[model samples]
Target chain A: MIVEVRGLKKVYGSKTGVTAVDGIDLNVADGAIYGLLGPNGAGKTTTISICTTRVLPTAGQVRIAGVDVVAEAPHARQYIGVVPQYNTLDRACTISENIFFHCLFFGFSRPAAKARTAELLEQFHLTERAEAYPAQLSGGLAQRVQIARAISHRPRVLFLDEPSAGLDPQSRIAMWDAVKGLRHQGITVVMTTHYMEEADELCDRVAIIDHGKILVEDTPAALKQSVGAQKVYELHLRDQPGRPELCARLSRIEGVSKAEQTGDGVRVLAHGADGLLSDVVSAASPFGLKDMTITEASLETVFIQLTGRDLRE
Target chain B: MYARAFAGLFLRDLYVLRRELFPFAIRVCMNPLLFLFVFTYVLPHMSGGAAMNPTAKMAGSGGGFGTVLLPGLMAVAIMFSGIAAVALPLAQEFGITREIDDRVMCPLPVWAVAAEKIVFSAMQSVIAACIVFPLAYYIPSVPVQAHVNSWPFLIVVLLLASLVAGALGLTIGTAVKPQQIGLIFGVVVVPITFLGCVYYPWAALKPIPWLQFGVLVNPIVYMSEGLRAGLTPSAHMPDWLILAMLCFFLVFLGWRGIKGFYRRVLG
Candidate 1:
């Protein structure tokens, strides 16, 4: 395991305190991309902070490459690189200088730092803006520079907190591509994101977290497969809901796997909706169906199934 | 390895300062330049000349006001440089950008990061002292002979006073809010400089007994008086007491500053 977290917990205050992180245990394999998928304020940032040795845990420990983070944080820092949720690039220095100085801080020789900085700038497609100050760059460009600088020292583990948080679609894809390229260098990556697609697209394994605890952990495929459906049809009725017979009648359809009553609706989960949408619509029409929506069973659906709420909430 | 990290941070600071050398020169020289130009040169050259000036009478010598101000202005330079180099920038970093995060990620202990700030600020303080020394010496109308009694003693005071200035800057930088940084000039800088034995010698404060004792707690008192003992023919506090107080302020402020820095950066 490149990153080992054991029974980790962080409580903000005393006995009746708010627990930011509750008993999280994870073992990430070398060279694997691990994602902590959660909503806002779900302890994802605190977990990464603990593993990166920025925050000391109230209980338990994190070991990065066999070194306990708490006992020797300085040593642990040698193996970990971090791109926090916000840009931390030195405002005083240019892009090239930021990366060069970072390498120098990690004991790189001047020439070595120069070479590494140049290589990172080229790798991240930031050579054109090498002399630009952080404030001069757009949000996407600045984020790219931050990523390049974070890994300039060649840390084995990189923690990116919300790497795609304010980026445009194009920049987010570029960021994902840059992260994927790191896997070729045998670097273990641990990232936190609320975007389900980002986690599904980038992670080798994804852990769904809520209210300071991991509710489930699996490959995106397995998680989706566990949902046992490909299409989700939500039927909203103007009339009374919680009608068990409506759900029972809908589940009897050919492609429908299961049906459950919601507040003013009945959700039908189906493996394939082909030739089954008409049957579902007709069955739900008797309850005075006001609206109907369809979506594929994705990580979002998996999260919704586990937590019974929208991830965005 | 720790040395490498420290050197890296130092060289980075040096590089940044190198680019801002002009502004740095202006920042360190402005206060003493105006003070010397107005008080020592303009005021003395006006109507009644030296006779009518109460400050000249207070010093009790015809060409002594400039002589007294030489070391006193140098002390001000050092203190202001410390605040400018360390405190002001630190407030911006801690509050606005959180740029200090990258430096803290270095494979060095957290305290070393704070130490690096003080060390870098101390160098600027030393440079500011050097800059102000020459200006204070030559700006007076009477060409007051700013003689150095002991070069070795002068150098020692310069280094100690610089370190104490940096420590003081660190303490202020970490203790205050970034939005409230302007308050430092009114609350910290003005009060300390006025009560810091800059305009007059500590010996002259003997008539105001309570104030003389009260100003003892201010670190700039020792800085101004120490430079007085080292650089001029003016009366100064004893050598042992000056050295002891400088060291005391350095340790006390350094401790408080480092603790504040640690808390601000870490969880």
Candidate 2:
């Protein structure tokens, strides 16, 4: 494991303390994209903060590359890079200067710092903005600069807190590509985000956390499988009449585990759609099935099934 | 490795300072210039001339009010620059935005970050004093000769006074919140400047026994008196006492400030 966290707990305030991270344990493999998937205020940032040695945990042990984070934070910090949730770039300095200073802070010599900064700026396609300060760049460009700065020291482990938070779809995809490129370089990536699709698309393994506890931790496919449904069948109806009746009849179909009214139709969850799709269509025929579609279960459904709430909520 | 990290951090601050040198120089010189003009020139000229000034009457053979006020103005410049260097940046860094997160998360130990701020501010304080020294001497209405009888003692006083100012800045910077920054100027800075023996000698306050003892707690008093002792020996505090007070303030403020800084950063 490149990163290990055991029994981690953090409490804010002393007398009337609010527990931010409550006894969470995690082990991340080298070169894997691990994600903490949760809504805002779910302690993902606190957990990442503790693991990255930015914030102290009230009780627990966190080891980065086998070194105890609290006992030897400076050593731990040397091997890890963090791109915080907010843009913490030194707006007064140019992009190149920011990356150069970051490398220097990590004990890189002048020549090495300069070379690494140049390489990162080019790699992130921020070469043109090298002379521009953070304020002058677009949001995506600024985020790229922040990432370039974080990795200028060539840290083995990288922690990105909500790397795509406030970005448009195109910018988000670009950021994801940058992160994926890092994983190819053998860097262990740990990121926190509430976007379920982001977790599904990017993470090799994800932990679903809520109320300071991990509800489940597994690969995105396995997490969806844990929902105990193989296929989701949506039956769009021409009218809302007999919707409850159609849902009740659809639930009784062979291999169908659950059915509920969704929009102007009934959505049915089944163990498998090989033989169940025809049965679902037949059951919906009496209710004037306008259209029908069947798809595999997704992380969003799995998250809602496990937490009883939307990830965005 | 630690040495290199410290150098990098300090050099980064220096780079930023260099980039903003013009505005920074203006901020450092504006107050001293105004004080030098008004107290040394305007006040003396307004009340007839330097010949009728009370400070001239007190210093029978020496220059006049300008000579006495020159060192005090240097002290003021050092204090203002030193405090502004750390206090303003720290306030914004620790505000709702939390821009200092990147700095504290460096591979170096937490206290190193605080040390960098202190040392940087100390360097700026010394620079401010150097710039103000000549202006304080030449800009006054009356002819002033700030006889530096002992260059070594003068250097020592300037260095120690700047260090004390830096330490004091660190304390205020880390201790106060962003919204409370205005209070730092109104409640702390203004009071210290007025009671710091900038306009008159500490010995002259002997007649007001209560104030003489009360103003002793102000760190600027020692800096002003130390400058007086080094620059113009005719009217000044004891050399040993000035050095002792500055050293005390340096160690005490540095200790408390570093502790507070560590707490804020680690939390």
Candidate 3:
């Protein structure tokens, strides 16, 4: 593992303080893309902050490439690349200079800094914007510049926090492509985001976090499989009938794995049996079934299954 | 390796300041230039200007008003330059722009990052003092009587004064909020300059009794008085006291500022 987090914890105050991270442990393999999938305020950002040494851990330790981040942050920084939620590109310098100065900060000679900056500009397709100031760039373009600059030193681990937040569809796709390219360069990536599709699409492994605790950690496929269904069918019915007995009946159906009553409906988790939909409709219609919505079992279903709450909510 | 990383930070500051050279020069030169032109040249050259110039009369005999102002104005330049170089940029960095992360994330210890700001600002303070010197020397119609008895004392005072000014800037930058920066000029900067003995000799303020005793708390008073003793040899404070106070202020302010910076950056 390139990144090892052992019993990591952070608290904002003493005793009665808000615990930002609560005894989290993670081991990310070298050259793999990992995701901490959670909603806002799930301690994902706090975990990343401690790993990058921006925030001190109240307990435990994080070691990146064998160097402890808390004990030798400056030494650890050489192997760490971070793209924070906010754009931290130096506004005083042009795009090229931003990368160039970053290289210098890591002790690259002037010639090496310039050459590496030029290479990164071309690699990130930012050559045309080399002379453009950060303020002159659009939000998406500035984000690209920040990512390019963060990797200027070729760090072993790259951390991205909410990489696609506030981006348009096109820019989000572009950002994803750029991140996928980093994997080919042999950099381990650990990203934090609430977007389930992003974790399903990009991460080899995903950890679902809520209220400063890791609810589960596994491959997205395994996590979805662990939910024990291929589809989730939500049936909104009009009458308030014997909800528990009705759910019991639904759960006993051949393809249905679980059934529960939600705020406005009955939720059924079922496999894609040939006649499951009609069977569900027949069972639910007596209560004046008003509407039905079907969604494939996804990382979101995995989250809702574990936490009993929607990721977005 | 630490030295190399430290140099990289210094080079970055140098590069940015070089690009801003024109504005930096204007900020450093304008105050002393205008002050010398009006007080030393324009007013002294005016008919009956001598009668109107109370500071010149106080300098007595052949000593022009420029003699007292020489050290005092240089102190002002050094202080302002320090503030401009560190505090102003810090306010913006800690505020909306928030681009300080990359700088702080450099492969140096956190205190080293804050130390770099002080060192860079101190260099600018020295440059500002140097710029202010010629303006004070050549502006007045009458010859400014600057008699330096000890070059070592003069050099030591200039170096100490520059570091002290930079430390003061760091303290202000870390203490003041970005929104409250404009107000600091009014509440802190201007008031200090006025009471700092910048326009007159400290000894001359002795007649004012309470005001003289009150201004003793101002660090700028020591700066102006130190320069006066070193460069002009007028009625200034003792050298040992000036050195001790400058060191005291430097340590106190640097400690506070670096602590604040760590809190701001490290969370």
- Model 1 has a DockQ score of 0.82
How many steric clashes does model 2 contain?
0
CA lDDT of each prediction against the hidden true structure: 0.90, 0.86, 0.90
Candidate 2 lDDT tens digits, B1-267 = 778888889889999999999998999889888977887778878887754445454443657777777788889988997789988788777775576888887877888888888889889998998898888888877777667778898898898899888888888988998899878999999999989988788887878999999999999999999998888744778889999999999899989888878767775
Tens-digit per-residue lDDT, B47-66, candidate 3: 65462355665554577888
Q: Which ranges in model 3 have alpha carbons more than 4 Å from their true place? A: A240-242, B45-47, B51-61
Q: State how far residue A89 of model 2 sits from its true place (Å).
A: 0.7
Task: Name the TM-score of chain A in model 1.
Answer: 0.97
DockQ (C-alpha) of model 3?
0.79
Every model's TM-score on chain B? 0.96, 0.95, 0.95
lDDT string for model 1 (A1-313, tens) is 9999999999986779989999999999999999999999999999999998888899988999999999999999999999999989999999999999999999999999999998999999999999999999988899889889888888999999999999999999999999999999889999999999999999999999998899999999999999999999988987774468898898888888889877788888898856888888888888898999998889998998888888998
- What TM-score, computed on C-alpha atoms, does each candidate reach? 0.97, 0.92, 0.96
Better of 2 and 3 by lDDT: 3
Q: Report the C-alpha lDDT of model 1 over B1-267, residue by residue, as the tens digit.
A: 899998999999999999999999998889999999998888777855562334444443445588778878999998998899889999999999999999999999999999999889989998998899889888887655456778888888888899889889889999999999999999999999999999888988888899999999999999999998887767779988999999999999999999999888877
lDDT, candidate 3, equals 0.90
Instruction: Write the candidate numbers in order of decreasing TM-score.
Output: 1, 3, 2
Ranking by DockQ: 1, 3, 2
